[model samples]
Each structure stands twice: as C-alpha cells, then as structure tokens.
Target: MPRFPEVAESSVGLSDAVFSRLVARARERGGKVYPLHVGDTYLDPYEGARAEAIRSVDHQRLHNYSPVQGEPALLDAILAHVDRRSGAALDRELVQVVSGATAGIAVVVDSLLSPGDELLLLSPFWPLVRGTTQRRGARAIEVPFWDRLESMGDAAAVEAYLESFVTPRTSAIYVNTPHNPTGHILAARHLDAIASVAERHGLWVISDEVYEELWFDEEPASAWMHPRLRSRSVVVHSVSKAYGLAGARVGFVHGPATAMQAIRGVQTFVTYCAPRPFQLAAAKVLTEGRGWIASTRAHYRELAHRAADALDVPRPPGGTFLFVDTRGRRRDGESAFAFLERCVDRGVLLTPGTASGKDFEDWVRLCFTTLPPDDLHEALARLRQVLDDR
Candidate 1:
C-alpha cells in the first residue's frame, strides 16, 4: 500500500485544467488553441454585480469571516428566492449557504452517503458529481437517460429505469436539469417520474439546479416542490451561470429542515461560511438582478442556436452548450478527447465527453456563451474544417 492511510481508492481525478496544460503546450509551440472545452463563460463578471462587489468589500464587516451557516441577510434572501421559485413554501431554517453548488453537493454527499452505498448518477453528468460521490467511498452507479433522449422523453422509460434499477442500498439520486453535456432540461413529467421512484425507494434526491433559470422552452420543475418528493429532496442552486457571477462562488441548498441542519453541520467543518462580500453581491443579484439573467440568457441562447446550425450534430434541447457528435472518420471509437485534439489542431477548442463518462465518447460539449456573434461563427467554422479535413 502507498503511504498516507492507504489512500482509499476514489474516482475523482485531474481537474479540467489538464486540457489547459495541453493547450498551453500547444501555445508554447505557436499552435493555435480555441478553448471551447469548459462550461465557464468567457464573459466578464456582470458589470453591475462587479461594481456591487467592489463597493461591498469597502464595508467594514466584509473583511471578517461570516457566520458558520451564512450571513443572515444573504441567507434570508436565498430563502425568499427559493420559496418563490420552488413554490415549496420553505422557511429560512431549511436553507444553508455555501461557497458554490459544488460545495453544497459535497455537504449532502458527506452527510447522506456512506461507503458501499449505491449512489445513482444520471448521465451524462457534470464531472464534479462523479468525483465527489466516489471520493466519499460510495459506489457511483450511472443510470443512462439522456443519450436516449427520444425514448427517455417518454416518461415510461424513465419510470422503468427508476423502478428496475433502484435497490435498497441506493442512498441517493442526483438530477442535473438543463443537464451538463446533453443540455436536456427535466420537464414536470420527468420530475414526476423521478419523484415516484424516490418516494417508492425511500431515497434522497439531490437536485442540482444551477442552470434552472436558463431553461429554454419552459420553466423547470423543482423536485422539492413535488408534494410526495419534498421530504426526501434537497435542491442546490448557484448565482454563477444565471447572474454571470461564476467567480463569486456563492450557492445555497434547501430541503428538509432536518437535512438543512445536517448540511449546516457539514458546512461548519468545510468552508465555515461563504465569503461575506461574495454573498453580499449574490444577494443583490438575486433580489435585484432580473435584467442581468434575462440579457445573458438571450445572448447565450442566440449563440447556442447558432452552434446547432453550424455543427453537423443535432442540437441539445436547451442549455448553454451544444454536445456535438463526431464519429465519422475514426476506425477505433471517436472520443471527446480525440475530437478536441482535432479541433485544437485548427483554432478551436471544445470539451471531450470522456470527462463526463466513457459513454460520451462520441460527444463533444462545446460552450457557446460569451463568444460574440462573429467569434462564435468563426469558432464553429474552424470546428467544421477540423472535422472535415484529414
């Protein structure tokens, strides 16, 4: 065994920064690299929100650490937003603020999942979810859904998966709506189907709704809002994508008052509390930044549509990305890494599907946010050339 307590084998490994290392090496050689890989917006912080942050930093109270749960003002604002949107009529005590959605998920996994417990992951998932669950020594079992979006769109398929796959050892079910790689938003029927599964199995539903506000055709149904599902579900949301405050790193989780208390206990040990000034900025954006999310969504939606038109693959239903499939030229399987490499040879960069799971080998997740019309067009054009060329 290796040193350091035998380092319990876990799945989480290597940050997406691995791509940056590759891109950096290419740059050093004067190779062109267009970075479409990460979901992060190249867009600068929302101007108004940034100004508020700078101003808040000047406030004497911000220099100190926040309360272990969160600052009262920020916490209350989050609760009000949740009550309004989730339509769950939750009290302030049910919410705990954290550094980001990722941190909130960590608290949930640490509190609820145990070693050997089967954790249900809905693939293609965001990479961090897989990393966090496995790091806890819990087995991550993926229930492939979106790849069969056509079939999964029929609620019966999702219902069957839930009915057949969940076992007594299943501790949690993770839902990523406005899903990461495929960009499929979970509809009310889908939520109803999942809620039924959770209700029957007595499982915890950990819903990551960081992109809830970015839904394309309709509003997303909150799992916590389902009457039968409310008691067993915890909802996580962030100011990053919607408010263009990714750097602020402020998010909240709300659910059962009992579970909220447990999350607070976990939060105390990890981050203590989110940064005071960042919380202050997020609070303002949530309560007063309506125009910001709308403008950003419209801008991103236009770009996403353009990407779909440009790429050879079908478009994702709704989200900030277009997951492109490029498998025509390869004899072995065409992986996201291989596709990304091809794009990099040109002047474009995109994330490989392998980061999510081996299942996404043919899928390339390309972020369409922040790039101006001309730049997005150019990037897509370059991507086409890379795939079409040798």
Candidate 2:
C-alpha cells in the first residue's frame, strides 16, 4: 500500500479539544449536557437572511458559480459596508469572497510564503494561523501579546519583534484584533507602530478582523485605514459571527488590488468561490439589515456582561469567549483537561486553554455567546460548584 503525504499535518495536529470532546460527551450524556464549550451564537438567524435565500433561489443566479472574484452584487455590498464603516473609498476590485476567513487566510499564506519562510505571529493566536502557515513549510515566529504589553501595549513588542526577526525570509505578519481566545483589541498607537514596522520591513500584514463587530464599548480601529499599512495588508472578515451564519461558510478578503488579484488566483485552485446562496444572503444583511445587526450586537453585549457577573470573572474587552483562570480550582492540581472533565461530569462543557497554545495550559475559555441567559446562568452555577468541590 502506498501512503500519500499529508498536505496539512500541522493544522490537523492542533485538535479542538473542547469541541470534539463536547460532541462525544453530549451524545453520551444525552439530555443532561449543557454545552458552553462552543462559540456559536445561540441566537436565531436574521430574518433578512432567510428571505434573501428564497429570493436568491428564485432568481436562478444562485444556482451558478459566482463570479471568480465574487458575485458582483456581493462585492458591491462589501464595498458599500466598508465605505460606511471606515470612510475609505474601497473599490469592488479590492474584495474577494471565500468559504470563510479560514480559507482567506489559507490563500494569503499560500500566495505569499515559500517553504521555510518565517511568518510573524501574534500569540496566543487562533492556533490555525500558525498551523496553516507551518503546513505550507513556513515557520511561525510568535510574539506574545500580554507579556509584550507589560503596561504599555502589544504594539511596542510588535515593533521590536519585526526589527529583530524580519529578514528577506519573513513573508507576512498575522494580526487579529478583538482577538480570539483572548479579546485584546489592538490599540491605535500599537497599530500605528505596527504599520511603521510593516513599512520598514516590507512585510505583509494579514489582519483577521472576524470579531470586529463584537466590541463592547468603542468601535475597533481599522488597520486597513492606516496609510502606510493599507497597501501591504490583507483584511479577512467573516459574516458567521456577526450574522449568526457560521453554517453558511461566507467570508471576504479585502486588500491592495495586487494581493486581491493574487488571492483570487489562489482561490481558483481552492474552493473556487464562496457559495452563491450565502453570498446573496450576506449581501442583503450588509445592505438592508443594520437594525437587526445592531439588535444582535446589543444582545451579545448583555450576555457577556451577565455571564461575567455570574462567574465573577472580569470580561475581556470584546469577543465571544470569557477566558478564566482555572488553576488552583481543582484538587491535586488537576490540569485544564482534567478540570474540563470534571465540569463535563456536572453537565457544563468548556474549551480548555491548551488548545489555544501551550502557554495557556492552566486557563479555559467559557463561550458565553451561545446558550440562553438562564441556561448560561445555570451552567455557570454548575461550573462554580465543580470548581469549588474540586
């Protein structure tokens, strides 16, 4: 028998401990399971999404492969939304849709990096960022966020890292604002500093702004608006979080015209195009569903606050997760995985920190976005009991 080499070894190794275990245990536990491990919104989908899907199927355009870059209507909608949000005159030529942000990231990595090139990564990251880049034979040189921040901000460390690590072999730097796993919104000064580093080093910035809409207080600053960084950056965003459309698998990559063209080239060999029906649905949400989007954001904000209050854990600035210090909460100094197992026994499934990176071994992420208010409250109660008892 012949064995084929794996195309995504690094990516496949970084298991999503919380999600996989929860699925198995939920099946075993049956009705007693209270799933708080997953980050999906328990909220209903936007009404416009449903109506638009019906309209799209009726129009027959949804049956065809969308324009190679994206369906024209969807591109226009993305451009209009960006213009309204950033006051920047974004052209439709700069937008390319993908299956989701993950696909967009893949295309960017493949288009930019050669094997053995180094990609500067900001950690603790989405894990897949490092995994995917590494799978392409690139090294992920990480600069830790909080440690670098000290009291200043992560931008300073970013600047320092670029100066020290960047070389001709360095191809790109990944930045995630309103970051996952840890919700650190990039500061304006940090972004400015990062832009200077990118300009000096001629490094590409792959900014994942998937959680840009989930801010609690202030609106997030767009790294795309930075003059020095605009032309060198690829901004990847998803409608999954904002529109409750994760299953739809819709996202877009907007950047300099040259890289946008390159992303299209990469997508041609990949998924080819975003699903036509989902793009049509996303277009409607971007154009005509501001009120519904606002309502959803407000609901998420309330849920974050409520869950934080119940857990008595300070909430991060923004994003769907509540990262908790689970250390010293279990007997015999149990590992995060063990603590997770105990919680599962009590019917609350949570994401263990080890999945994010090795540095977060004692931490665990509580997904507050899904589960109703009362259900979340009960889960928190059960979690507290499990922790206290242990």
Candidate 3:
C-alpha cells in the first residue's frame, strides 16, 4: 500500500504540539493564562551569560558557524564543569557539543540503534525522549518508575523489575534524574541496580543530566561516576535548565572515546554545530554562573515546596515539576482531559500526564518555576478551586 512520495513510517503518530489544544483554549479565554505546562524558568539568566552580552566587537566571527565539533572555549568549559561535578578526568576528544540535549540524544540514538532496536525508557520521562526513540524506528519500553520508587521497595527489587522488561532487542537504557514530571532524584542504590542490569546485558547507558544542577537537597552523584556504568555510559548535559538559557540551544555529550567518534559523525549530519554565539554564552555561564545557580536553587526549592503544599503532594526532590495523580479528584465519568480543561478554564495550563508515559493518563504535570511567585500563587489558587469543587 505504498503511495508516491510517501513520508517515513517513523514520523507517524509523533507530535511536536502536545500542548496546542490547551494553549489555543487559553488564548481564546483572554486574561492571564499562567503557563505551568512547559518546563522553563521565569528568571532571566545571569547577566554575563545572556545572548545580549555576546558582542561582535568582543569575539571574532560571532555569528559564523562553529566547527562541526564545537567552539574550543565551550568544550573546555564543559570538561572542567564535568570534572568538578563528577570528578571524572575525561579526554577532550570524548566530548561533542550539539544544539541541545534533545538533538544530542537523537544523535546518540542514530549512532547506537538500528531499526527495531529497543530503548529502556524509564517513566514517566521527559516527554520528548519517547518521540526521539520512535523517530529512530526504535521502541521505547516504558517501565513505570520515578512515581513508583517508594512502592517498589529496595534497589534489588527495582533491578528485578527493570530487568524483567528487557528482551533480546533492547540495546540501551535512558536515565534522567532529578527526574522530570515527578522530580525524584535517583539514589546511589538505584544507579547500582541500573548499572548491574546494563552491565549484565552489555547495553549502553544514556545518562541525561540536564537537571544535574537543579537538585534541592544534597548534590546527586552522576550516573557516569558509577564504576560499573562508567565505560558504557554516554552522558548528556544542558545549560538551559539550570542557567535559564533555553533559547540559546547549547548542550554537550561525552562518552567512551570510541562511542563518541560515532556520535560526532552523526552530529555532522544533524545540526552540524550549535549556534556559535550561544556556545560562547554557554561557556560564560559554565565558568561564572555557580553563585547564580546557588541562589536560583534556593528560590526554586521554596517555590517547589509552596506548589507541593498547595497541591497537597509530596515535595519534589529536584527538577521543576510536580506530577500529580488527578484520578481521585476527577468527577464521576470525567476523563483526564476534562480535568485539564477545567484547570484551563480557570486560566491555568498544565501538561497532561499521558505526555510523559502511557501509564500516566490520569496524571498531570505542573511546573512551579514557569511563573514568578505572585503569578504562581494565583495560578495555584485557581487550580485549588477546581480541585476542591470535585
């Protein structure tokens, strides 16, 4: 049943507009629509790291294409930042700067996975990773995680549960923490379980550390820092989440030298290079934004607790979101989408939980950092009314 000039099968059912309908509804209603759906900060980035700070007068070829790998300055900064955070002495050749973590992961998928290969995607994950796998003609095997960590009991049990989902076709495991949606940071024991499973299967570990700098309590150890996972892991990082420079589109990926060779090759065919000016900006942030990160972390922690208290959910350990199960609060015969519509009617927008995982259809994800304190408080107040009315 082939038609002329048909699109690829992989593109089917993939959506880049998960929030379009809700956003349209919000637009129609007018007034202030608190955008709690997207994961972004209301605060501006550090002054020196901002795009406006980069000037043609200061740097040569400020708008030109950077080298395929990346600008040397940004790469050096990433190496130093990684060393400080994880204490790993990475070779300079092992790093590849890309447009962002999304594209970085895509390049990884292209390099490592063949069609029909499986990626062990821990859920509820960052929404885009699922589509990233699908676009590669690979399947994302969702193991209900993060939200189920406490109920899953010990690390051994977690390992057993994850391993049970693996099959001969599974080629890699994607790990993110402090996780999106739920915001639970994986402890060492959990990483041990993941490493054990990946090592036994000889599968690659794709460590997503974009939220690495956003932890609330103690600093979390990187997955690549684990002895067993070290050689097999390829870690991805972004300045977007921590520095509030999402529009800059700068992220870096590093791994074993051999694996990085293929990733860099794929990067050439993808975006070629991240924007040169933003690379300079990202370097500035990596080197000079620690104090900014500390103050922002404290601010985010307070906001996280406040939002959690308002929603009556457990406070997130890190990351920007609170994944709430709205099932209990739903009216009889009302669907998950209906509950979301009720919230939007009150001028508050939330991401449907089904965006994160197939098993999370009855849940909703809220970003406390998306709005400033006064606006966020008002949004929560409107949301509370909807919850109470049920």
Give all TM-scores, in the order shown: 0.91, 0.90, 0.98
Between candidates 2 and 3, the one scoring higher on TM-score is: 3
Candidate 1 lDDT score relative to the true structure: 0.76
- Residue by residue across 1-390, what tens digits does model 1's lDDT show? 446756546633625464674576457657545567667776766665684554644677666898877778787778777767766566777778889998889889988888889888888888788878878888788777777766665566678877787887898889888788778876667778888888778888998888877866556666556677777888889988877777788998888877788899989999898878888888877777777777777777777777887875665566777776666744356554665665776767676676676687777677887466777788889877776665
lDDT of 2 at 293: 79
lDDT of each: 0.76, 0.78, 0.92
lDDT winner between candidates 2 and 3: 3
Rank order (by lDDT, best first): 3, 2, 1
Per-residue CA lDDT of model 2 for 152-241, tens digit only, reads 546665577556767778878888888777666777777887788888878889988788788888887676677777888899989888
lDDT tens digits by residue: candidate 3, 1-390: 437787789987888799999999999999889999989999999999987899999999898999988999998899899999999878998899999898999999998999899999999999999999999999999988887787887879889998999999999999998899899988887888999899889999999999999899998888778898999999999988989999899999999987899999999988999999999999999999999999999999999999999989999999999999997888888999999999999999999998999999999999999898999999999999999987
Error of 3 at 42 (Å): 1.1
In model 1, the worst 10-residue window by lDDT is 7-16
Q: By TM-score, who's the top model here?
A: 3
User: Which portions of model 3 show Cα errors greater than 4 Å?
Assistant: 1-5
